[model samples]
Target: MANHDTETTEKLEKFGKRLKELRKAKGYENYEQFAFKNNISRSQYGRYEKGQDIRFSSICKVLKALDVTFEEFFKGFD
Candidate 1:
């Protein structure tokens, strides 16, 4: 059970990092540019990608900004 939880947490961290990288790879320069491109506030979006526990409402908004469904973000997880 602990192992499963650890794996899920690790996967979330990886996803968060991947999102940050994608912003860079997409040539957005920084969070400010990325958020601006997606019409989100930079500081707030930073909190979204920080991989910390956040409200579902904020999560949904962030997912919308990322242009991904929950299934897409969570992929192989059940």
Candidate 2:
């Protein structure tokens, strides 16, 4: 059970880092700018970037705003 939890946490962290990288790649240095531009809540998006729990719908929204397909987002996934 503990191992499963740890694995989930690690995956979240990796996803968050990748998300941040994608945002930066899209020319968003400030998270606030990204959130505002993408119509996401700044604080909530911040939590997502910090590897906090987020809804799948929210993830989809973010990905859509980034112009990334689900396949592209999960590319190189473990």
Candidate 3:
């Protein structure tokens, strides 16, 4: 349903925003630097931080690179 799609999109965007904030807090000024340091593709990481859909496995990898636990990553989710 359209509503479901909208909800998913909203959740993804919120997650992306949170990811960006966390990255900044870790002193990563650019996505390329973060991705490179984490062994992720820079373009893919950019997309992830831009609210685009990303794979769950990739999300896990990013969380690991950020030194964040799953619970910490999903904190404040509604």
* Candidate 1: stretches off by over 4 Å: 1-12, 22-27
lDDT of each residue in 1-78, candidate 1, tens digit only = 133477677766676676686567567777888788877777777765665445678667767776777887667554
> Candidate 2 on 1-78: residue-level lDDT in tens?
133488899888888898999999999997889999889999989988877787999999999999999899999989
Rate residue 65 of model 3 by lDDT: 93
Ranking by lDDT: 3, 2, 1
lDDT tens readout by residue for model 3, 1-78? 133487898998898998999999999999899999889999989989988878889999999999999899898899
TM-scores, all models, native as reference: 0.59, 0.92, 0.92
Instruction: Give candidate 3 regions above 4 Å deviation.
Output: 1-4
Q: What is the C-alpha local distance difference test score of candidate 2? A: 0.89
Q: How does model 2 score by TM-score? A: 0.92
Local lDDT at 63 for model 2: 97
Candidate with best lDDT:
3
Q: What is the alpha-carbon lDDT for the whole of candidate 3?
A: 0.90
